[model samples]
Target chain A: MENQAQRSPKRRISKDHWTAIAFLIPSFILILVFVYGFIGWTGYVSLSNYNSLVPDFSFAGLKNYIYLFNDFRFQADLRNTVFFTILFIGLVIVLGMGLAILIDQKLKGESIFRNILLFPMALSFIVTGVVWQWLLNPSTGFNQFLSVFGIQPKWYTDTTILAGFEWGSIEFGLPVAIIAVVIAAVWQMTGFSLAMYLAGLRGIPEELREAARMDGASEFQVYLKVVLPMLMPITMSVVIIMAHISLKIFDLIYAMTGSGANFVTDVPGVYMFETTFRGNYYANGAAIAIIMLLLVAIFIVPYLWSSRKGDK
Target chain B: MAAFPIGKLIKYIILIFFAIIFIMPIYVILVTSLKPLDEVSLATMWTLPSAIDFSSYVEAFSKLAPNFMNSIYLVVPATLLSALLGAMNGYVLSKWKFKGANTIFTIILFGMFIPYQSILIPLIQFLRTIDLYNTIPGLVLVHVVYGLPITTLMFRNFYASIPDSMIESAKIDGASFLGIFRHIIIPLSITGFVVVAIWQFTNIWNEFLFAVTITTSDQQPVMVALQNLSGSQIVQWNVQMAGALLAALPTLLVYIFAGKYFVRGLLAGSVKG
Candidate 1:
């Protein structure tokens, strides 16, 4: 292809070039105002005294942030978010990658299995929450099946903090009830990692695996030593994507189980919604939103930067 | 190769087990929705309904029908507008690249990963200021704006695969910017359009945070109404399950029929980003 610079004189513009800018201007402006501008406004609100229903944008200087750090519910939300993000991302990787490898084996009825795993990805998180709420109900749902084995556990309703120890007016351990939410989340989202890994696996040439086999690597070792290493980038992408989702998760937990007893399942997303909308604590909500954005940015900014650099 | 058979058996066992776990909720939804209230209980949770009951469907449809229409109204135009804007921006970014294009693209892409909470306070306030609050148009605008990042990313990646040689040759032939887009780029990007449209449709249809907060009561979408159904005082498992199915039906149908494009959209959205 001819170089683009070769066709046009240095620093001279064309009508088409101006038209292209015009085409992009609207979306550029919208994103600039809505995303960047809104974030700035929310940040300002977080620092202001805007806790009441009526707008109060007076400067409060980190009062909301300080209060959240010391608040019981917010403390629990932080703990829950940490546990949820770790468990959710871990399970999604293991299950999704495992399922992807199995499906990549050229087995009979492969598409059928793949479809079953992926169909849930199409449904709304709200629907998943509603359906799973019933399916995991402690007294009436999966417990009945578990009862056949003489074991039943209270699912989401359980507020028990496993390995409980006091920290900041809340337990500094995994809330057992969170396991139920994690199960539903993993089920809905594992399909994403599966699809991603499947695409990555397909991109890897068969000759590479053949070469590994020739090196006396067994089938398991071929995957462990040869394949899994090659799929690292895909894993990185999945982790970042799932991390963002797990961090901002609201609809699923809201629909399936509201902040459970003792706020075990309360995430920043849920807390933000209830505080801001339900309770009219706008500044507090904005603080939560800012924190959520920061947590997500920790994963996303570096990922976006490196990916753009990679594109070059 | 003597161990191959056992390995294969174990793979099948594991795959089948997870598959069952994945499909279990659907089975529960179906069985519970079809059962009479008397039979929808802990003891019979896993059992098939004694008689197929359509009353839950009637009730759920009647309750969710209006909000269901609200979602349809919101999704259709939001999907179209976002896809069109994305295509234009993508064409500019990929084919008509100027300096700092990558930086601008990166900035725009950041919007996609943001927790919507960060913008919710201001978004609602802005909507109210503009008199679009609690209206379907308000939701549509929100979806379109937020939807731009992913749609733009998808279309940019899609258009990137189209060789620059084609655009360069077309420009040499005196084809104007819109001319090339109209004559060549648009025609070649039907599949790109499909993937992005289906993605936007599904996302806007299934979105909840914006739906629940922006619109309340009658103006709310199906998902919020469905949540309300379950959250209401007297819990009706049958109706709740039926409502879940009803709310999920459109995207479910889209997945069943055009799932290939949907999956393509999924991979395009995540992998390319």
Candidate 2:
């Protein structure tokens, strides 16, 4: 009887562990094959000489990467992505933080205002793109409305490089045409940062603010020092999240502007799509994909690292 | 206290100004969508339609009808399957802790941050190899795989809130693993399921990159179809606006009714990650 009791408990525990692992097995296999396995395959393809529609797995060194780095369209895409990221992140933070503060003032019809601001977030970026495409049409849409104020500037069609300079066969300047695309992006994503900032603001204890007030700090001082510093973590989260979205932005740009005049608004994501599917430059596209992955990794890997450490 | 009214007034002015900027595009689209073909012009953009018109909607709906169905067929099964798989994975990771469970989770969660563009080439090649290219099932599989990281994180965090003691007590009763899950976990996770469902539904519905890449003409989801609608020559502003509204209606309704859950899911997904 004693032997049976001990054996039964051990077997039950093993059985439980086995079942638990069994539950994870399906997800494990799928993620392994789909995420990690496919990533490895892409890395290999990036290093190969497979430029056609056919799958030639024969190896070539970093030649494809070199070719892309020297390519004008790719260079333009790099420049556009850099400018877009800077402008998009800058505007989203400003607008989102600004709106959050405005709403936090305990305005009347708070939910109504909040809903209106956030409603855009619900629509797909494609829809946002289509809507904004029409609105920012230089000849029509918002241009006509703005003409009443005498501000009729070419929107997406404008390819003038502001503060233009050249470096290593790439123009290092803001493409004015990308600004229209940026506006649409900022409009769609500002709600996210707004919500995050509002949450972060709400999380601050009233006692902290009251204590600051008792110390004779002005309202601006309180926000500048206490509230903004307190919101740093949320801001980091917002930046990393927005950076990922911006780096891989496709649909909005694709629908809003197709590679723009002079490829001014072209991004790597759209470039990769067209190059691979439209142009059938498969190897070149793979190299672009790898470079994008490396850029995202630079931002996200460290984030995951720090966040994991924080969790511990 | 005496300065309060002026402060409040200034606050209202700022709020109203920003609100107007935020609502302008939506207002333009709404009005433009309602305008008849000839009335849809730059000058009339800010003006309300002279008369309510449904003809643009009629035209857009007929054009977009097939792709709209495609989106439905794609989103429903994809959401359910991903959520179910996430629930299962969450049950194991949280309730049934094992060696390297956290490590395994961190690995899976890392998948969420991948730009996905990185994997497109191989993903396409693999799908073609498997003969699933240009099919809805192929897109569904891609979504489910990519969605695992976020949904797993969601359900795991959710299940963590359910005390481990419940599972311990159930285990002490000689209930098997499946029994404990079927009896205890599933019943308790109805709200978790709802939140995950809403998140996945919105995401998969709004998703364009995968849908655009994975599916071709007939199999294209509504977002891609919407893009195609505008891509053709001689763009009809009224019809296009109406098509945009039609494409947005389902998710817009979800946001309207379940805005609370949507926000909750967003917070949970981002904050936890």
lDDT tens digits, residue span A122-221, model 1? 9999999998888888888888888889988988988888887999899899898899999999999998899999999999999999999999999889
lDDT (0-100) at residue A149 of candidate 2?
100
Task: Chain A only: list TM-scores of all candidates.
Answer: 0.97, 0.94
lDDT, candidate 1, B1-273, per-residue tens = 455687789889999998898999999989988998788776787899989999889988999999999999999999999999999999999998888889999999999999999999999999999999999999999999999999999999999999999998998899999999999999999999999999999999999999999998989999999999999978688889899999999999999999899999999998864
lDDT of 1 at A145: 80
Best by TM-score: 1
Per-residue CA lDDT of model 2 for B1-273, tens digit only, reads 456588788888888887898898878778888888878776667788889998899999999999999999999999999999999999999887666788788889888888787888888878999999999999899999999999999999899899877887787799889998899999999999999999999999999988988899999999999999998777687889899999999999999999878877887788863
Tens-digit lDDT track of model 2 for A1-312: 643454363454568879899989889888888888888888898888888877788989999999988888899999999999999999999988988988987777999888888888888999999999988988887788678899987988998989989865867799999999999999899989989998989999989988999999999999998999999998898898899899999999999998987899999999999998788888888888889988888998888878767654
Query: What are the DockQ scores of the candidates, in order?
Result: 0.88, 0.76
Badly placed stretches (over 4 Å) of model 1 are A4-11, B1-4
Q: Which ten residues in a row have the lowest lDDT in candidate 1 chain A?
A: A1-10
| DockQ leader | 1
State the lDDT at B148 in candidate 1.
97
